[model samples]
Target: MGSGESTTRKVSFGVDDEDRVRILRGIKLSEDVLQRMRGVANIPPESSSSRQQTILKDELAKMAEREREAAREELVKTMSRERQQARKEAEKAKELAQQLQKKDSQLKALDAFYKEQLAQLEQRVRHSHMFHRPAETCLNVKNQSRNTAPVCPGLQAQILSCYKDNKDQTLNCSDLVKEYMQCINAAKKLFCLLINSEYDLNCISIAVSM
Candidate 1:
């Protein structure tokens, strides 16, 4: 019996040893898996800092792009305003030029009208002088032959003097012009009557001689 008990105790001891071995192996495998997981979770400091820097650079680039877009929009608006102002100024200049051209045309037309009036006045004065000289010569010859006073000589001199004094303003001599015209008509009528009477006298003398 003593031998059998000892043998059983030895067998039981062997079985406990095997179970301990298996539990130790299982713990070791779990520790290895935990170590691998820790290694994967831990990152290098340089790599972390580099990633942060890359993200910061990307943010700064985006900000810069936004700023550039804003500046472009502002420039476009400013250019548009400048174009509009230039167009308005050009229109104003065109209008002013048109007005100046119109005024110039009016001045030229007025100048032409004044020149025409002056030319007509000069022509009338020349014709009056021609008619007056012939009438004066005839009146003088008739007066000498008839043994009579000169006709309207004083009035003729006065009219000529008035015309010379008021050359550019001939209307100032209107009163003198009317009086001189009346004197000339009377002289013409007197000359015609004298010519008719002389012709009758000559005819009577010719009959007597026959």
Candidate 2:
């Protein structure tokens, strides 16, 4: 190369002052590169991605509703079981109360029946005691204070026969005993004779009244 001659080569791309001459001669951008640059500038919004997000949200909501329904169903089943148990308990209590009332009524009836029987038995005993006192037997025996004789079997037999014939009276033994006592006192001397004669008659009247 001769002294003072140029040696720098000029280029278009990446051009500095050495390549500036080549760039001025002819420098054009490629169509494919220009299209890629325009695509970057006009990027579309993420509308499809937003739609997917909305679909996912709807599915989650449906799932939440299903969970709530399941939970409500379980709660209803639990409450129904509790209510049924309570109803059974209430019925049992009511039955127990009725049984107790029945028992009380039966006891009261039995008590009243027993009391009636007792009263009847007492009345019979009083009547028998009043009518069957011993008499003084006066035989000519030495050093005899008073020979107390037991009730005559024949007289008692007659009286028993009379009572048996008329044994349906409501009168108690006390009433007949009181009447017979007064009769005996009024006829003290002939008391035994009168008693033996009217044993059946008096006893029958007493039994009928009783």
Candidate 3:
């Protein structure tokens, strides 16, 4: 009976040792699973923060590009306005130059016309002086010789009358001047013939008396 009780106690001890090994293995596996779950949970927050930073950077870049485009558009508009204003000013200057040139031409034409009129008046005055001196000499010669017929008396009277009627237009007496010249020439020829005839008569009378 002693031997059998010893054998039974050994069998009980072996069964208790096998149950402790299984329990230890189960506890180790549970700890490994809990650690892996904690690692998965921590990774998500870091990844989400990185994604938010990328989105913010993209928005800032887009805003900068829009500002640059607006600045370029404004510069183009300002340049266009300046060019239009310059063109208008140039056109106005050209028009003013044309007006000044036209006025200068008109002034030159007027000056030439006035100068021509003055020259004509001076020539007329000289002609008047030439005729007046010859008329006065003829009158004196006529006063000294009352016995001889006055040379060109009627034509001289007509010339004087024409001059009186048209004081400013002395050229009106051209026909009277021509008649007076012809009368003077005829009178000179007649005077020469009369002098020759008188000399011949005197010679005849002296010879007959002798």
For every model shown, what is its TM-score relative to the native structure? 0.38, 0.34, 0.35
Instruction: List lDDT for all candidates, in order.
Output: 0.57, 0.53, 0.54
Pairs of residues clashing in candidate 3? none
Clashing pairs in 1: none
lDDT digits (tens) for residues 110-147 of candidate 3: 54554454355335434433322222223323323324
Tens-digit lDDT track for model 1 on 63-140? 999999999999999999999999999999999999999988886675565446445544544554333332333333
Residue ranges of candidate 3 with Cα displaced over 4 Å: 1-33, 38-60, 117-210
Off by over 4 Å in 2: 1-36, 40-66, 121-210
From the highest lDDT down, the ranking of the candidates is: 1, 3, 2
Clashes of 1: 0
Highest-lDDT candidate: 1
- Lowest-sum lDDT 10-residue window in model 2: 133-142
Q: What is the lDDT of residue 179 in candidate 1?
A: 68
Error of 1 at 28 (Å): 15
Best by TM-score: 1
